[model samples]
Target chain A: MNKYKRYERLAAIVKIFNDNPNTLINLEYFMNLFGIAKSTASEDIDILKDVIEKFNFGKLITVPGAGGGIKYLSISNIDSYRSFVKEMCEKLKDASRIIPGGFLYTADLIYSPSVVSKIGEILSYPFQEKNIDAVVTVETKGIPIAMMCARALNVPLVIIRKDSRVTEGSFVSINYVSGSQRHIRSMSLSRRSLKKGSKVLLIDDFMKAGGTIRGMMELMEEFDAEVVGAGVMISTQKPEEKLVNNYISIFVLKNMDEEKNIIDIEISDWIMGE
Target chain B: MNKYKRYERLAAIVKIFNDNPNTLINLEYFMNLFGIAKSTASEDIDILKDVIEKFNFGKLITVPGAGGGIKYLSISNIDSYRSFVKEMCEKLKDASRIIPGGFLYTADLIYSPSVVSKIGEILSYPFQEKNIDAVVTVETKGIPIAMMCARALNVPLVIIRKDSRVTEGSFVSINYVSGSQRHIRSMSLSRRSLKKGSKVLLIDDFMKAGGTIRGMMELMEEFDAEVVGAGVMISTQKPEEKLVNNYISIFVLKNMDEEKNIIDIEISDWIMGE
Candidate 1:
C-alpha cells in the first residue's frame, strides 16, 4: 500500500477502536475489512498504539498468541482527571445550582456530552481490567454517565427503571428504602436486559445513603448477576456511614450553607491520589 | 517538533473532535496546548481534515475570521449506513423480538452504546448544518439514543420525565394522547433543562403514532424553545399519516407477520438516498 493509504487505514483503525473501546478486534476482521496482509495489519496496530501512548489519549492493548487481538481502553491522564474534577467542583459551587432541599443541581453537567464523556472515561478506568459484562445504573439522571461507561467498557448498558412499562414485557421489580429520604421506592429491570451470572458495574450520578446502589445490588441478585464495582460522580460527606461500602466517588460535597450561599466541594481522595 | 509527536497530536485531535462532534475548537486553544505557531496549527488541522475526508470518517469545517475555529461534523458514508441498517433489520426479524402488543423489543439495541451511537450519528447527519442547541427525548427508553444524538451534535441532552421529581425542582408538564393507543400521557421537563428560545432536535427509538414526539413538542413550547428536527431509529409503515410529519427514521418496518414469525424492514429512504 502507498504511504497515504497507510495513513488512511491508521485513521480508520483509530476510529473503529475508539468507537468500540475495550472490545477485542481480531486481526482477521481488519484484514478482511482492509484487504491487507497480516504483517501490514500488525504494523498499522503498532503505529496506532504508539500514537495513543505518546499522546496519553488512551491505552491500546495487544494480546499475542492464538485467540488474541487488540483492545482499546478509555482512560485519561491523571492531570486531566484532576483538573476535570476540580472544574466540576467549581461548577457545583454555583449558588444557583443549590436547590431548595440542599441538593445540588447537576442536570446541566450530567447532560453535557463533553462533560459526561470525560467523566465516564475517568470512572471506567479502574473497572476496565475487570471482565464486566454490563454497566448498570438506575433510570433518570445516571443514564448518561452509565452510557458513557458502557461505551468505554464496550458493554451493554442495563438501566433499572422506576416503573415497568407494558412495552418492556416482563420485568423484575424490587422495593428499597431511599437512603437520604428514608422512603420505600421501587426500581425495575426488563428481564431481557441482562443475562444470568453476568458481571456488572453499578454507576450513578450521586450517592446519598447509598440506598440506591444497595437497592441495585439487591435487584441484581434477582438476576443472579454479580456486582463487580460501583462508582458515583458525587457523594456527600455527611453520610459517613454509607449503605454500600466499596465504591468510588469523583467529588465529595463537604458542606453547603444555604443561607450564606456557601458551598464546599473537593475532588475525592481516590481521584486526587491518581 | 518530531514526526512521532505530530502523529500523537493528530491522534489526540481526532479523538477530541470525535468525542465532542459539531463543537468548535479554537485554533488558539490548540496552539496554546501544543505551544505551536499559527501556521503549524493550520497544517495540523489540514492533515486531520484530509485524513477524515480521505477515509470517509467525517467532516472537519474550518471557520475563518474572528470568533471562529474548527468543527468536526459526524457523517458516515451511505454504504456503511445501509449495511448497518440492514444488520439491525435482520436482528429485529427474530420472532422473539415481536412482543404481545406487536411492539418490537428494542431495549437491547437502544441500550447498546455501539448501536445507539451509530444510529445517533446517522440521525444527526441531516441536522449537522442546522443551528441546534439541544437534543430532547421522552425519558426511559429514548435516553440513550437522545444522548447519542446530543453527543454527535455536541449539545446538552434534555430528558422529559414521565413524572416530575423533587430533585428536578420545578418543571413544565404537558399532556398528550398516545397516537396509537389513544391514551392520555403526561411528560415533564425540568425548568432549568433548556434555555428559552433554544433550537432543539428530538430523537427517539421508535415512532408508532408520533404522539410522543408531538407531546415533546408541546412540552418544549412551555419552555419557549423551537423544535428544529425529529428522528427515530424505527418507524412503522401502518401509520400512513403520522401525527408529526417531516421526521426521519433509520428503518421502515413494512410488516410483521406474527403467525408466520416474519418481519419485513428496509432502510429508511432518507438513509438510502444518501
Candidate 2:
C-alpha cells in the first residue's frame, strides 16, 4: 500500500466525510486507507474538527466507545444562509415571475440543483439532530426539495404518489382535502418504502393551507411513522389558518397581485431569528 | 484576514469542490479567501490535481486564459462503479422484490440518497463533457435520481408533469403511448423551465419500451431544446427494440420468473465495458 502524506490524508478525509454526511466512520478505516498509525489518524481528525468549526462548514461529532466513531453533520452558518435567502427573495420579487393565475412561477428556482441543495440544507438543519429516519413528500412538485432535504439529512426519501400504481406492490394510501382548492385527492406509499415506527420529516415546495401536509401526516399514521417535523419552501399568508398547526416555512408569500405585476415575499421570521 | 496553513487550505478546498461539483471556481476567490498569493493558490491546485487522480475521486480541469477557471467534474472510477452496480444486482435478485404483474419493486433502492447519488454520477458521466444545460425527467419516480444528476452536472432540473397544474403557468403538453401498458397518457412541461436551444439530458428510473423517453424527446422539440442523451436505471429484455433509438440503460432485466422467484438481472454490457 502506498503511504499518504499528512495534507493528502486530510484532504481525502474531508472528501469522504462530506460525501457520507451523518455516517459514522471508524478511525481505523482512515488508518487502513492511508496506512497510518491510529494516533496519526486521530490527530488528523482533531485538526479537521477545528477547521470545520472555524469555517462554519458544519459540526464534527465524535462518538465514544468501540462501536462509535466520527460523523460530519451539515450545519450552515446562519448569517450567510440568511443572506442567501435574501438574495433569492430579491430574485423572486421580479414582476416577470408572476403567472397568469395568482401563482408565482417558481419552477425555475425550486428545480435548480444548487438552489434547492442549499434550501435542503437549511430545511434539514432544524431536524438534523432529531435522528430523522426519512423525509416524506407527496408526488409532483415537492419531490426535488424533499430529495435534497433527504440528501442533507442522509436519509431515504419516501415519496407519496398521488395515484397508486401497480408497480408499487402493496401500499397504504389515504385521502385528504386540499386546503386551497377544497378538492379530495388520494396519496399512497409503498409498503416497503417506509418502516414502522420510523421518525420522519415532512417536506413540500409550497403550502397554501397545509392540507397536503396534513394529508401526509395522516398517511404516515398508517405506517406507524412518527411525524417529527414538517417544513415547506413557501407558504401563502391569506388563509391565516392552515390545516396543520405544526409546520415551518422558509419564505412567506404575503401577496401576489397579477394585475399589478407585483409580488411581496420575504424570509420567514423564524429563520431570520435563527 | 485570517491566514490558513497549507494543510488546512487543502482540506477546505476539497470540501468546497465536493460541495460544488462541476462549478467553476476562480483562483482569485481562493486567494482572497485565504489571503494567499496567486502563485501559492496555483501550487495548491497542482497538488489537488495529483491527489484527485491518485485517489480516483474525480477529474479537475484548469481552464486557461481570461473568463476561465478551474472546475471539478464528478466522474467515478469505472471499475469501482461496476462493482457497486453488481452489488445492487445481487440485492435485486432476492425474489422478494417481485411485485404482481411481473413488476419488480425498486422504490427502496432508488429512493436511497447514497445509492442514487452514485447512480446519478455514473449516468451523468457519459454526458458531463457534453455541456448539458439541464436534466429533464417526468414527475413521481424519477425526480430524485434526476435531481442528483443535475447536482452532479451543476445544472438545473426540469421536471415534466404527467398532468399539467395551473401553478406551472403556461406549459407545453403532449400525449404519448405507455409502452408497457399500451395506454395513452399526456405529459407537460413549463415553458420557463427550460430555455430554447438548450442541451438537455434525459433520465428515468425504469424503461419498458422507451415510450416515455420518446415522448419526452417529442416534448423537447416543442421547446426547441436539444435532447443530447437519455439514460435509464433498468430496462427490460423483451421488446428489444425500444421506442427511441438513442438511449442507454444501466441494468438490463433478462427474465423475471415470478413463479420460481427468480430474477435474471445484470449490469448492461455498455457500462461494464466502460
User: Which candidate should be chosen as best, given TM-score against the real structure?
Assistant: 2
Give the Å shift of residue A234 in candidate 2: 0.8
DockQ scores of the candidates: 0.71, 0.83
lDDT of 1 by residue, A104-183 (tens): 88999999999999889888888988999999999889999999999989899999987666476788999999988999
Tens-place lDDT digits, model 2, residues B1-274 = 4389988898889999999999999999999889999999999999999998888899889988897889998785566587788899899888898888888888888998899999899889888889999999998788888998999999999889888664667788999999988999999987888889999999999998999999999999998999999999998988988898778888899999988989999888887884
DockQ, computed on Cα atoms, for candidate 2: 0.83
- Predicted structure with the largest DockQ when compared to the true one: 2
TM-scores of the candidates, chain A only: 0.95, 0.96
In Å, residue A260's CA in model 2 sits off its true spot by 1.8
| Candidate 1 lDDT tens digits, B1-274 | 6444666567778887877788889999888877888898899899888899877787899888798999998784565577787788789878788776687888889999899998888888889889899999888788999999999888999988887674767878888999999999888887888899999999988898899999999988888898998999899998799999879988889998878888888787767775
Off by over 4 Å in 2: none
Q: What docking tier does model 2 reach?
A: high
Off by over 4 Å in 1: A1-6, A30-37, B1-5
What lDDT score goes with residue B194 in model 2? 86
